[model samples]
Target: MSDTDDLVEIEQLLARYAVSMTRGDVDRVLAVFTPDGAYSAFGDTYPLDEFPALISAAPKGLFLVGTPVIELAEDGATAAGTQPLCFVEHAQHGMRIGYYNDTYVRTPDGWRLRTRAMTFIRRSGDHDSGRPHAFTRS
Candidate 1:
């Protein structure tokens, strides 16, 4: 595929992830990542296998993801991207605004995230309630 094609695919991949995660579809969310993928947030990084629980543990919300800025690697096998995120709470009157830093790999199944880290910029209401899952960007 051409670089444009790759960029489109990666953009769609990011959309897929946001939609799936907002819908709380664990399987679909997992599909956007490599089998050995890892997600970092809440001051911890969870392996692919642990992602489901991490998903379940979060409050239900709608993920409003901004357009991603992606940079393809010279090797053509990897890429990096970042996007703004707004997680509006559905289960409660709360919200968490953040951004995602992602590392993508060209798997046989297509572009998948190898690593995804969330950096929270703000939180409020039930979202800021005594849940110890908040973390900062490094």
Candidate 2:
């Protein structure tokens, strides 16, 4: 596939991630990542194997994902980008805005997340009530 194709696929992968997380579909969310993938947020890192439990422990909410500025590697097997996200926590009655720094790999199944590091920019309303701590970008 061309670079453009890769970029589109990667963006779609990120979208799927947001949708899955919003729906609290831990399985689908995990599918978007590679077997050894890692997710970092609020100063904690969770490996793929432990991700499901972590996600399941969180409150359900609406997660809106913005388009990312993707940069494809020359070899076309790797890519990186930063995407803005808005999360509305129903249980907590709050919202958190953040950005995800992502690394993607062209796996046999398609583009998968290798690593995703999230940094929150703002939080409002019962923000501290959620399992994930409120954070600000430094």
Please write out the lDDT profile of model 2 over residues 1-138, one tens digit for every residue. 887788888988998999999888889999999999998875677789878777866667999889999988888788889998888998776887878889999988999999998777744533222245433322
TM-score of each candidate structure, all chains considered together: 0.87, 0.85
TM-score, cand. 2: 0.85
Clash count for candidate 2 is 0
- Weakest lDDT window of 10 consecutive positions for candidate 2: 122-131
Q: For model 2, how big is the CA root-mean-square deviation?
A: 5.2
Stretches of candidate 2 off by over 4 Å are: 123-138
List of clashing residue pairs for candidate 2: none
lDDT per residue for candidate 1 within 1-138, as digits (tens), equals 899999999999999999999888999999999999999887788899888877886788899999999999999999999988888999685877878999999999899999998888753422211224553222
Error of 1 at 22 (Å): 1.4
CA deviation > 4 Å runs, candidate 1: 123-138
lDDT of 2 at 129: 21
